[model samples]
Target: ISRQKRTHKIILPCFIGGRSVSRAKSIVNKDGCYFDFPNDAIRILDAMTRSSRDERIVIGKPVLRKIPVGTKIQLPYHIVERNLHSVSIPIIKSNFIAPRQSTPKGLRFPLAAKAVVRSVVHKRSSGAVILDIASRGQLNDTLRRFSHMFARKLEGVYVQPMAKPGTELILGYVHDALMGDVYIAGIGGSFTEDVHDIGFYVGKPDLRGAKAMLAQLRHTSIITSIDVPFVAHQIVRLSRLIHRHPEIIELDLNPFIAYRRGGIAVDARIVTMQT
Candidate 1:
């Protein structure tokens, strides 16, 4: 037999002429019996013939690779992680404030806290989520309880502050394989899926596209009334979000509340093709 070993710098000969090569190879281990072709037949024969205690060996492929396995992975969770690391958006950081903390200034609400990081959008058969808190103590307790319900850590929870309708809008960007990046403007919130009112345009859009979308909406009258503030400025901010990140694939600003002058994405989800 011809082989190389560390004992000798070069190839060395073992059992010069007496050793006979076999076609099959086998090894006995504690686990189970293992055998494979294109292997060392001599080793297989030796192990079989040698006297040993009853033991099991695994018989399988010539070689098996080991991989460090973890818990099962979810697609949506993975997408969220990717977006968290790669996508750039002008949204509030959920971790900045402690759980059950009040929303910062300029984003305050009457009944509910503004800029809550909602779990999912569109109230499906599962129903909508509500985190009611009469006082700060209840808020902290609810925040802690919600932490255990989800798969991952609860960075931010939903805030249901009082908000006037027609102020909130949807802003999004999708990567078109053909057209490159496309921006979408539409009225969103609970009625997003139900209403399905929106406008689509390609590339970085100007104020024109934003106005066009707002004008076409059924609730265009609310923006004109001027009773509340932050109606027009919110649209401009939404427009800027689109212009800032051209690589965004899909985004959701569902039920963004427009209060006085500026708007806040009370609930939003963003997807990025760049990841």
Candidate 2:
């Protein structure tokens, strides 16, 4: 043992890989099961940290659920929007046209439409998402093109008014098999991935954590142009939203248009496990 290990009386963490424990009493000296391997490891680690002179919580809780054996299904835009109302994601109002229906009355012009395809990620450039329908003729033309392009895979159409311009931001979360849910905040828009300016965080979200994350961005001063606190609060809310909905394995709110008074999500994608 290293001198430091011996001095601190550290507990060696056990990972039950291939080795068999026929007795199978418990991993944590008769307190946990083999099915909960890594969790047991985490519990042990937390115990070891508590043994420190200054004790504190290591990882507060496990956010993501155990892996399920089923096909992955993405929640379509309409369902996502409906569910998001409860979470207060500041999503702009939108409508759907599955089973092929006419446009809802009273929707303003300069709208956008996206295809309800399960396998593909919709993007404006890919033609899965079409933007800027200035007139009814343009809307019809776009729908026909969308119909022709998607054909059998097409489920329906998602239509929403074009959102107003605002400073763009991104709120994203990933359910990591090992680390659990990892949330991210970053500069957003069409090139969010390309720019690669982001901050990653672990643990439950709060205003403090959200503010700290936004502060890490390259352009920290950009907060002056928008309601920085609201943006930060949105990040916190999005994290909690995912925490509440374990079915959501991955989610992205890119180009969350942020204006002085508030912000709105122009585009969103949620990946989930089929129940």
Candidate 3:
């Protein structure tokens, strides 16, 4: 169909014989030649078609693939934090106490009694599964058991002191085929899925832009009570990180606890093109 007439329809450009062409014609548009093919044959064409601007373009509907599991191993917390800093998000201060299997008897009791410790096993996209250690007596056993249970499916275990209670917020960026990189932020943590409250913006946002987006959330009151300017600055930094790192496809800072004094990322997950 002519470009003027086809403006309203979804236009999928196809490159044939080193030249671009429009293969399919609208049924209602009599100006272009239409071909009637069997349903099975049309399905084949649909499977092969790929779109430049459509993010969902694939040979067929995607399906889940099974991944092999392995034993969980602990990584140093400082190393983890250092690596995450490359992404421009603030990492919570933590320590890798001990592997679940080899917890020292003398250390476990003292670590749990005084400090509010949290055991976490990190995953690429799933973030970390956190378990709070109430008493020193339960630390060793709990870590060992939890490690064995999720070892095969997750990366490794690490322990850190829990952050102070504060307003939790989700900050992220996703690359869209048409829109490029998009920034997302909203109420996070346990309420992330339930609330589904979020705001989206195209490209990188400045401090003012970030604050404006934050102001759009339903729980703006909570966010405003804390350091709004600090959060906005972090959002802008995250956007810059996305722009600089094209390999990063998705990045999430969940439960980004915001206090009146400052903010800390309780948990973070990043998915790169290589992963």
When summed lDDT is taken over every stretch of 10 residues in candidate 1, the lowest stretch is: 10-19
Q: Compose the digit string of candidate 1's lDDT tens values, residues 156-218.
A: 444445444436566665666699766666666666677787767676655665556556666
TM-score of every prediction relative to native = 0.47, 0.69, 0.59
Clashing pairs in 3: none
Q: Write the per-residue lDDT of candidate 2 for residues 1-275, one digit (tens) a residue.
A: 23323464433333232224323423232322222233434544454444434332111112111223343545435446655665788898766554345555666899988776656753655778888889878877877887888787676667789988888888888888899878888888876867788988887778998888877888766677778799888888887777777667888888688888888998787876523
Better of 2 and 3 by lDDT: 2
Q: lDDT of candidate 3?
A: 0.54
| Weakest ten-residue segment in model 3 by summed lDDT | 59-68
lDDT of 1 at 240: 58
Best by lDDT: 2
Tens digit of per-residue lDDT, candidate 3, span 206-242: 9888987788788768765778888888898887666
TM for candidate 2 is 0.69
Per-model CA lDDT versus the true structure = 0.42, 0.66, 0.54
Evaluated at residue 125, the lDDT of candidate 1 is 25
Report lDDT (Cα) of residue 224, candidate 2: 74
lDDT of 1: 0.42
